[model samples]
Target: MSTRPNDTPQTLIDQVRDATASGRPLRIAGGDTKAFYGEPVAGDTLSTRSWSGIVNHEPSELVVTVRAGTPLEALEAALADKGQCLPFEPPRFGAASTIGGVIAAGLSGPARATAGGVRDYVLGAQFINGRGEWLSFGGQVMKNVAGYDISRALAGSMGTLGVITDVSLKVLPVAPAEATLVFRLGQHDALEQLHRWGGQPLPINASCWVKDATAPDAPELLFLRLRGAVAAVEAASERLMQETGGVRMDNAQAGPDWAACRDQTLPFFTPSSAELCLWRLSLPQTAPVIDLPYAQLIEWQGAQRWLWAPASAAMAIRSAAAAANGHATLFRAGADGAPGVTRFDRERSVITTITQRLRAELDPAGIFNPGRMG
Candidate 1:
């Protein structure tokens, strides 16, 4: 059982004050598994791993408050003991991934489309700002608020605004049952079917469509995961199989397959010799199959897509995604060191202004992980 040191908060405040006085940047870290995310940074490491533990848990109320540095796996296990879970299905890149990193990176798994994102689960947070002032926002229960919910806003901030100390999140019970199904279909048909199913009241929890160009003759595949009440899952599974001629994937295979897709451990994620960079595009779910210059694996019912392309194709790919009323992110750079590619989506002027204003107001000294999201 990890314990939050008796003076963790005050220690954090003192460290931030010293950093501010000396004008030195501080990089906030829990397990450090998500170092590759956001812009590369330089700063003195302010380790939060020791200030870790579940602060409070009320299973009846469906809320859990945990220190920022608590290992994500530990928290999940705790919730599992209660038969509840963080429905967003946050991905833990490494065994030591912490809750703080989850909120900062804001990466959710396949269930994100139907369940929710990190921000949606966030209920409250405690943090130390640039001036070494400790502050908190929101509460344990869910409710509608008139003003901005700073706790939720911190979800994807990448630690740029402040050093998060603790957070409270809403949780849900596990579904009573689950089923996985796979179908052989082309890109167009898969997209069409996914959109069609998205409109229905099915037990669909997640999906993924993959295309392998190397195996030209091999059939393209679409994988669907159904989860809910036992009756609902079985009914939906039978109906889907009947409609799409899909095979019911055995739990032995389905479990690992879904895990691989959620953690991005599939063969598609391996760097290809021809295309070295990885790109992630987020578009409307109803958008048609794009005519890009690279192969893609569509997820989130066509709302999220992943591709492998060389660095030189970044601009063209972004342009195509933009034309489709979406944005593309350079998820990974090439092994050979590619240039002129940015890692995140470019926000419009109004959104950018709001983001900047919030950052300035929260970290006025600009000492909290500078250039972290550049």
Candidate 2:
């Protein structure tokens, strides 16, 4: 139960440098919203809330840079005004989930494919490395040099090697419109349909599950974001409607309704009654797929899926994904059941050693997010 304090980059670097130089550990906190995202960390926590605000915003350039501690909501509002947005949808559980948290967790919503993940848009970032040195990487532009893409690498690094202070990103102009098609079908059919559509060129931003108690297969919402002129959006929607067989156009012109789909907010959060444990699985695209025991839906089929499984079957779930060349992550874990594990796909020994060395070098005293990532 580490409390939080608002601290600036200089202060954080000083603290981290001192801690690393010595042997103290400092907890990293941003919006305290994504605490459940990974394994717990020990020691006192440092909050970025105080280091807030959009450091830079160029609407014309389509790049709005901001501090890591800036509120996701604030970014959204600002981008909304400019008709631009962070392509990868990061869940804003509350004001606590800051841009830093999104980067730390590498959490992106269903709009990930066409929209891209958090790492994809990261142009440049300023952070305090473990040596406690304030460092910067990337630029305000989309393309950058090769080598260690520091900015993007930090995207899913989970704040282990360093603490993010500010980030610059290539924002996407907000789409003129979006349409959601809610199709009620068998669990198996829903997945097949989404994959079928994925192969074809359709204006789809996100394809995922909508688990409602009333309708088991209740409604599978496929989001198709349309940009450019109004006619283009309408034309794409019509083309999509024609291609989609059993899918029903729940909303031809969805406004804010699409935002509601950004999270597994409630029902999915409660794991006890909900037998389907949340597992973020990435399976083989063409494997002989078995309809997961619990309700299942596909997002970039062959790429990823947000699934629910029984806690008792954790080993089985991991095995299935492993055999199929994918991995699974436990999103919601119950008190009694072992929540799903969070290690990303396995890394080679060389990669692992390199990572461990970096972690040690950055946090020699080994304090910030000690076990959270390694």
Candidate 3:
């Protein structure tokens, strides 16, 4: 874990420049909280956590620009002071998770299905590319519809293209009120209800449907979060309960329940054994539940599903997901790793070609977090 001292943009630039000249690759490390994500990397460490802080925050304009190394909690606290928040509800794997890592990892939590992902809120970005040249894209203003959205493209890129230095994110005011409703139903029935509700105007913001893995015959529970105007939330709560025989969850129970799911603290995330791996499936909400030899936890109204299965079941799971017009990932693998397996879903050839071309144009030297997203 040896790393170069990079406390400023210039120092980081110098390190990257030296790496380029020496024909060496540099692994971008900000907060180092998400090291387990994606493919394991290899390169000299380029630490950016030292260069941190909020650069600009205009609460009136609902935009906050911060150094990439700024902690996610710090940014969220700042936004909370203004009664604003990141709508996508990005998760923090560690207490020191940085804004740069969040964007690079491109992961969003429960609200992602309703409010969009990291990219939607990314208004602009500044980064250092493979050639050690600083580049800027997009802007903080909402009306900035001028060019190709390179800033958004960097979201979920896993730092393969460049090293992010700063980012401009659009924020929204905190909801006036919120509530959680729970329903007990089979997986098929729960998914059907979720899709049916999607067509109507509801205050639903986030959802999770999970079954008891220990007892296959046990009933599944669906937790739905509603957030918006107080009246709307209350109205939706009453209507949903009556329609689905759902029970409203008390705040004492609701808060920790949602937090557990968002942070993967729930039992579903815990692997059963050394040979078990956590798999995440992303599919269309309309896709039906597929039969798999593993415990399943459905989320995002069925668009995102989690399972704990043996490492050898990767292909079977992926195939089932593909049949349902979705894809799967080996989110958390067992002790005996699945060697040579690409963690991410294989993309279409055209999409792969375009991605490769973009990588070549932005990181021809393959110096910035090589193979991180593959």
Candidate 1 least-lDDT 10 residues: 1-10
TM-score of 2: 0.86
Judging by lDDT, tell me the better candidate of 1 and 3.
Answer: 3
- lDDT per model vs. reference: 0.87, 0.69, 0.88
Work out the TM-score per prediction: 0.96, 0.86, 0.96
What is the alpha-carbon lDDT for the whole of candidate 1?
Answer: 0.87
Off by over 4 Å in 2: 1-8, 210-229, 246-257, 266-269, 272-277, 284-288, 337-345
Clashing pairs in 1: none
lDDT of 2 by residue, 77-158 (tens): 8898887888788878776678888887787876776677888888988888778788879989877756787788788788
Model 3, span 135-232: residue lDDT tens:
88999986785767889999989999899998899999999999999999888999999999999999899999998787668778999999999999
Ranking under lDDT, best-scoring first?
Answer: 3, 1, 2
